[model samples]
Target: MAYQTTLGWSLISSGIVTLILKVLPYDSLWWGLLLLVLGIAILYLRIS
Candidate 1:
C-alpha cells in the first residue's frame, strides 16, 4: 500500500478510537495512549 493510504487508514482507525472514547463516559489517559500506540504500531508494521 502507498504511504498516504496507510497513513489515512491509521488516522481513520485512530479517529474511531477517539470517537469511541469521547462517546463513552469512562475517561482514562491510558486508554487513549494505548490506542495511539496501537495505531502507530499498526502503521509501522504496514510500512515495513
Candidate 2:
C-alpha cells in the first residue's frame, strides 16, 4: 500500500511537471530530456 501510494504520487507529480512545462512556452524537447534524466536519476537512487 505504501509503495503503490508513493508510486502513484510520483507519477501524478511528474505529469503535473510536464503540464507546467508545456504551459510555460519552453522548448519541449529539452524539457522532456531533462525530465527523462531526472527520472533516471531518481530510479537509480531508489534502486541503490
List per-prediction Cα lDDT, in the order shown.
0.81, 0.88
Model 2, span 1-48: residue lDDT tens: 999999999899978987888786668888888888998999999999
Evaluate model 2: give its lDDT: 0.88
How do the residues 1-48 of candidate 1 rate in per-residue lDDT, one tens digit apiece? 699998998799778877888776666577787777986898799999
State residue 41's C-alpha deviation in candidate 2, in Å: 0.6
- Candidate closest to the true structure, highest TM-score: 2
Candidate 1 TM-score over all chains jointly: 0.53
RMSD of each: 3.4, 2.2
Clashes of each: 0, 0
| Model 1 stretches with alpha carbons more than 4 Å out | 36-48
